[model samples]
Target: MEYKWIDNFIDGLIDVYGTKDIYELYDSLEISIRKLPKCNILLQGNEAFYNRNFLNKEVVFIRDDLNMEYEKFILCHELGHAIIHTNIITSAFSRNLLNLNKLEKQANYFALKLMDLNMDEIAFEGFTIEQIANSFNLPVKCLKLLLDSKNQNI
Candidate 1:
């Protein structure tokens, strides 16, 4: 089946949710995922999850023991999968990118799009990838690739 593109998904969500800031979007997802439903179980695990038929749902697995940016990124990435790949109706990727090439790309693209970052600001603002990553408190490699892709697009 032909997949519905992620841009369309985000556009629709934006229309319903109004224009939310990038961090706010992340924060909202963070809030929603943290409060896992008991029986309805939109999220099934703290490590990760993907519902083939579910429109948009994911678990970030942010337990108290995991206190790190990488842990935070897990939530972001799971949200990315939900937002970008839900229509595919199945997933075959591991948490590590080495096993799942396509999900890795999709997740990164969704993350950057959700951040609402662009090349003009990133290139002209004199902020290095590290600076941007630091400001966002995200992993540097993630920011680096996102900025690089934006540069290539420009």
Candidate 2:
């Protein structure tokens, strides 16, 4: 089943945020990330969490221990949840695992969409998969998932 709302949400983001750049989404949406107390267990294990206030202000509590690239991806994913699932102001935690649940999948699609990444721009003709991902500052594992999703959609 197609989740049409995801597309609508993307449009809303572009209209409201005035840009499709992933790095600017948080500031555009007035969302903030708090440095959560880094538990080695949580940091070493890959987990990010987000919550929305009663006033609808959103804050993502992330492990500061995460590398910059991973942190950016998590911010996008959490922003996805905040925008696409507005009613879900309740706290949620996400792990860097291949979660195929509806919400998780929607958030993944949202992240990819916000990134504005297209296969055509990837230019994989002569470059290795790692090269393409590296050039895009993408996590190889997540990029592979996006690639798979894009291919399936095509």
Candidate 3:
């Protein structure tokens, strides 16, 4: 799907926030982020989630078990939902498939854009998907999502 709107929205965020750091972006948006403690549910494969708390405050919860890089990507993904799908609660689980739905794809694209990675530039430099994924410390499937969406006219 063409997501030029999402691209523009992310660019607007970067222009306004002056940074692409997920933590800083969340802070600037007044969204609270929490780290979930290790538990049975977390062990059952929940990676992260975003929701409006009882106070109607936006909040993102990421599992503590993830590596720093993965955690950052997860945060960015949830932030996507918070900004792009404000009325919807979203979650990321290890078991979830990529490209599962329009919403998921939007969040994935948002995460990629928010990271400020120039896919065309990277590809022009002769980097393979695995190499890019390894270099960025991101999951292979996440990079695959980016690759799949690359030719979709933004």
* TM agreement with the true structure for every prediction: 0.54, 0.68, 0.77
- Please provide, for model 1 over 15-92, each residue's C-alpha lDDT reduced to its tens digit, 9 standing for 90 to 100: 876754544665665434453333334344444444433335433433444435444555556667766665554433
Give lDDT per model, in order. Answer: 0.56, 0.70, 0.78
**Tens digits of lDDT, candidate 2, 1-154:** 3655677888887898688766687787778877765774534454676677725767777887777766677778888888777665342443333243767777877777677676765357888778887866766766776777666762
Q: Clashing residue pairs in candidate 2, if any? A: none
What candidate 2 gets wrong by more than 4 Å, as runs, is: 40-46, 54-57, 89-100, 120-141
Candidate 3 backbone collisions, by pair: none
Estimate the overall C-alpha local distance difference test score of candidate 3.
0.78
Give the lowest summed-lDDT range of ten residues in model 3. 89-98
Which runs in model 1 stand beyond 4 Å of their true positions? 1-4, 19-32, 35-59, 65-74, 87-99, 118-128
Instruction: Return the TM-score for candidate 2, rounded to 2 decimals.
Output: 0.68
Model 3: per-residue Cα lDDT over 27-138, one tens digit each: 9999997787757464346787777673778777678888887788888988888788765533565326434487877897899878866655745487776887887778
**Of candidates 3 and 1, the better by lDDT:** 3
TM-score of 1: 0.54
Best by lDDT: 3
Cα distance off (Å), candidate 1, residue 143: 1.0
